[model samples]
Target: MKRVVVGLSGGVDSSVAAYLLQEQGYEVIGLFMKNWHDDSVTISNECPWLEDSNDALLVAEKLGIPFQTVDLSEQYKERIVDYMFNEYEKGRTPNPDVLCNREIKFDVFMKIALSLGADYVATGHYCRKGILEKDGEEVYQLLAGVDGNKDQSYFLCQLSQEQLAKSLFPIGELTKPQVREIAARMELVTAEKKDSQGLCFIGKVRLPEFLQQQLQPKEGLIFEVDADSPVYHQEQPTFASQEEELAYLSKNIAYTPELGKVVGKHQGAHYFTIGQRKGLNVGGTKEPLFIIATDVTSNTIYTGQGNNHPGLFKKALFIQQPEVHWIREDLKLKAGEKMEVMARIRYRQPLQKATLFQFEDGMYVLFEEPQSAITEGQFVSWHIGEELVGSGVIS
Candidate 1:
């Protein structure tokens, strides 16, 4: 029998995944990843790792599979936590869950499983894998889950062809409700456990408090720019080429203190993000104010009156050449070539129609409709039909 290592995350989905793999006649081993250790930052009584580890052990015992816990705290801190702090310090929002899957789970954990004579490593992610033949070579495809409402292909966007080759997503074909039902039948300990809402493998966190741990607070002024500000009335300039036009459209508007009146003050500009509406604490506006820009260098926060503010939307976004990742290398675009694809900048977002343009320096994704909060340091994934072809960090 082929050997498989399942990342039994102490959740209902993973529990069901282990059971299904066992029924398929594979020699399965359960491994629960302990990715975090600092509970001081996590909310009290949340889904702590101890509870999760114990539950994973119970599931493994019930399934009659050998199990162990892998402590990846050091790697997680360096790869995901440190990177998150660095990004936020530079006024950019980083997706740690995506990073966790890429750096820790698939890279580090997969290597460990391979050393143990496992042919594949499985997870409970709500995404599917497909195989295609191209030029007599086997090509792997990362397809969206059958469950539209629970599709999680966006989180695995950074996966490569080789990574996909050794990965298995057993619950991808089942919806959330179906997985729950299976777990109920199996009487898994996690059958009724609520899904974790915090960072991957880490419990729920008070973000501001978490950041405050390392990022010292500094008072900053918050300015509210008007919808009709003169900055938005700039005359359109003629573009020399399509690339030039895309560059202009994707450019972020610079904000200065003089752009608007001071509405309030914030503990730190780095704590906020584009399109954020909460934690402002400022009141008395005709409409609720939303964060449009944050300048860490100046420690200033810029806000717009409402969600409809033009500053919050962009028609295009650029991705540096080094940052672009292609899961399907065969379908990569050549320089001066463009392809129509569906793309999303954040997880759980509905796919939007976009065109991908490749140039010598980088790639640009121009959307059919303006997108809000095209924040830097976030991954933007592109798909063709149900297969995720490529992804890149927004520049």
Candidate 2:
């Protein structure tokens, strides 16, 4: 029997994954990863790792599978935690969960499983894998889960062709309710456990507080820019090439101190992101104020009156060539090439119609409709039908 190492995350989904793999005649070994160790920085009583490890052990025991815990705290800190701090410090919004899957789970943990003679590493992610023959070569496809409401293909967007080759997602075909029913029938300990809302493996995080541990607080000005600012109505420049046009369209608008009235002050501009509406704590507006942009170098946050702020939306975003990754390498676009694909910048976002343009500088995704946030440091994935072909970090 082919041995499969299941990342039993002590959550209901992973619990059911292990059971299903066993029934499918695969030799399953349950491995729970201890990704975080610093409880001081972690929020108070927010699903501690110790508790999760115990729960994972219980699930493995009930399933009659050999189980062990792997302490990957050092790798987690260097790969995910440190990178998160570095990105936020630079005033960019980073997605740690996506990085976690790409760096730690698939890269580090996968290597360990392979060393143990396992043919594959499985997870409980709500996404599917598909294989097809293309030009006499086996092509792997990363597909959206059957359960539309719970599809997590976006989180695994950074995965490459080789990573998808040995990865298995066992619960992709079932909806959330069906997974719960299966766990309930199995009398699993995680059957009724609520899903983790915090960082991957690192429980509930108070982002501001967690960030404060690494980024020292410095007071900064919050200016509310008028919606009718001249920056919005500026004359378009002549584009010599598609790359130049995309480069201009994807760039963030710079806000000056004189742009608007000083609405409030923030601890730090780095703590905030584009399209943020909360934690501003500034009241007394006709409509709730939303953060339109932030300047970490100037230590200022530019805000707009409401959700309809022109600065809140962008039609295009650029991804550096080095950051771009293609799961379907066969479908990669060459220089000056473009393809129509459905793409989204973040998870749970309904796929929007977009066109991917590839140039020497990088790849750009221009959406048919304006997308909100479009924050830097976040990964954007493009799909054709159900198969995710490529993804890249938003520049």
Best by lDDT: 1
Error of 1 at 336 (Å): 1.0
lDDT of each: 0.94, 0.93
Candidate 2's displacement at residue 3, Å, is 0.2
Q: How well does each candidate superpose onto the true structure, as a TM-score? A: 0.99, 0.98
**Clash numbers, per candidate:** 0, 0
Error of 2 at 371 (Å): 1.2
Model 2 compared with the native: what TM-score?
Answer: 0.98
Number of colliding residue pairs in model 1? 0
Q: Which pairs of residues collide in model 1?
A: none
Tens-digit lDDT track of model 2 for 1-395: 99999998899999999999999999999999999877887777779988888999999999999999999999999999999999998989999999999999999999999999999999999999999998898899999999999999999998988999999999999999999999999999999999988899999988899999999999999999999998899999999977889889898887899878898889999999988899999999999998888999999999998898898999999988998899899998998899999999989999999999998878999999999889999989999999888999998
Highest-scoring model, TM-score: 1
Quantify how close model 2 is to the true structure by its C-alpha RMSD in Å: 0.9
